[model samples]
Target: MTTASTQVVLSLTERMPTTRRYLMCEPRHFTVEYVINPWMDPTTPVSTELAVAQWTAMKETYESLGHTVETIEPVDGLPDMVFSANSGTVIDGRVLGARFRAPQRSAEADLYRRWFLDAGYRDVTMPSRVNEAEGDLAWTGQILLAGTGYRTDPAAHAEAQEALGVPVVSLQLVDPRYYHLDVALVVLTEATPTRQAHIAYYPEAFSPGTQRVLARLFPDAILATDADAACLGLNAVSDGRNVVIAQESTHLIAELRAHGYTPHPVDISELRKSGGGPKCCTMELRG
Candidate 1:
């Protein structure tokens, strides 16, 4: 290989970036799913039930921690509609309109345009397909890792990356459980793992080439134990050092604390039933 290429590869390997941070929805927006989730049932008239109370507590907790909350009216189809924080595909000043994949919330992307504009994010462009969502995109030290399986495709990720004038790698996902890359992996960058980025996980589904790519980028990766990985919001957001993991991931809680990180645990058990957690509900623009 060329000397220049080798140097570039070496430099790119295992280098972590600062953890990006972001805000969550406020009280009004937090109570969204109460109206939409029941539509999935299609039985009796849709009801908000106890979601209002849940959203209230979640909003208070988020605000108590100093995060700005976003609010919006409940749209019919997208139950995850309130997690506007999850719609986080930004570069420079541009917002990558999430390409919707799940029909249940296909309209979520439909709602992104207005949200982006209202949120003051003007430079918005969508991946080729009109269905990609914000949660599908994962940034590993500026290198975009797109997970394609049931929710997204390689072509979709390629289009988004190409348009953004960035490098991207399709991290093919093993379906049903690890729906998005964020759910299966949380990027521990210089912000969280001390300047060494780790694509934390327990899956053995990558190809040799893919494995090589990962190793070359972040070599200090820790393939987490199932318990540490799954319940603790394994693939959530972090600001290089601090993380927002699921409260259920108790062991990881100890690990992060031992490493000197100010970890925040969010109770997302209710969302888990719908294939979501911390990462799925929010996207970190600045960790």
Candidate 2:
């Protein structure tokens, strides 16, 4: 039986039509895996129960703000399916379902296909060959930057952009640890109502290419502080003057204030542990 899908996953390209716009998504569904990253190994022990509570609270928070959310059902055998961060590359009207780079998380495509189709995304396309998940994709309206590192490849990124008929900028990752794009980058500006354009990426540490790309993207760029970047400050949603950030990311919250913006912080530690911060978990679709 086919389940009815009412939400329309929006594309960044459409949001970028103007300057700054307002866009918010309801966090109705989310998942947090049992095993955290190998690097952040904590033998202290964590519970899936606690994680779900956080996820549920996050969803409720979004609902309070007035947006609908859908639970992306888990596919058998894939533990990470609970985390719908690695799903697709959405821009304009195209919703390109992703192919996972991690062999363990590859089953997400078969699971997510229904959501895209049911949402009325007809221009869906896949790589003729093979590719990584869309979580590795960074959409900035004008340029779709793909991280060519652990979770993504040249071919996969190229295929995604081609399918969408858009130009892509490949950010070569020297640090193998920050493999997935979301870990290192997030589009900070999607505040516009009609056209939701992002502020692009700002590497807190330092990256000349990163700065150049951002400078080129926005004429009057809002430089988010490095302290905020450390706390995933750069990974936030901006509604013009209002900004929503992760609770644990302290530096980002302060930086947001310095730049003259009201910051709304919520606990997203569970989401971060599962390889998604704030931006990864959402695909904005407003017609």
- Best model per lDDT: 1
For residues 1-287, write the lDDT of model 1, one tens digit per residue.
Answer: 56866754554453423423354442232223332221122333322443444445555555556565555556654566656544557665656776565455666665766766887776677666642445566666567777766567677776777666667877766534555666666766632334444556545435456667666776766566677655635845565545667788877777665444557777665555444566655645431
Task: Assess every candidate by TM-score.
Answer: 0.74, 0.73
Per-residue lDDT value at 18 in model 2: 21
Query: Can you write out model 2's per-residue Cα lDDT over 40-147, one digit (the tens) per residue?
Result: 333444455655665566555555555565566555455456545566666777767767655666667766767778867798886553454445676665667777
What local lDDT score does residue 282 receive in model 1, on the 0 to 100 scale?
A: 61
Q: Which has the greatest TM-score? A: 1
Enumerate clash totals for all models, in the order shown: 24, 14
Query: What's model 1's TM-score?
Result: 0.74
- Candidate 1 residue runs with Cα over 4 Å from true position: 1-65, 85-88, 190-196, 205-209, 285-287
Q: Ten residues in a row with the worst lDDT in model 2?
A: 4-13
TM value for model 2: 0.73
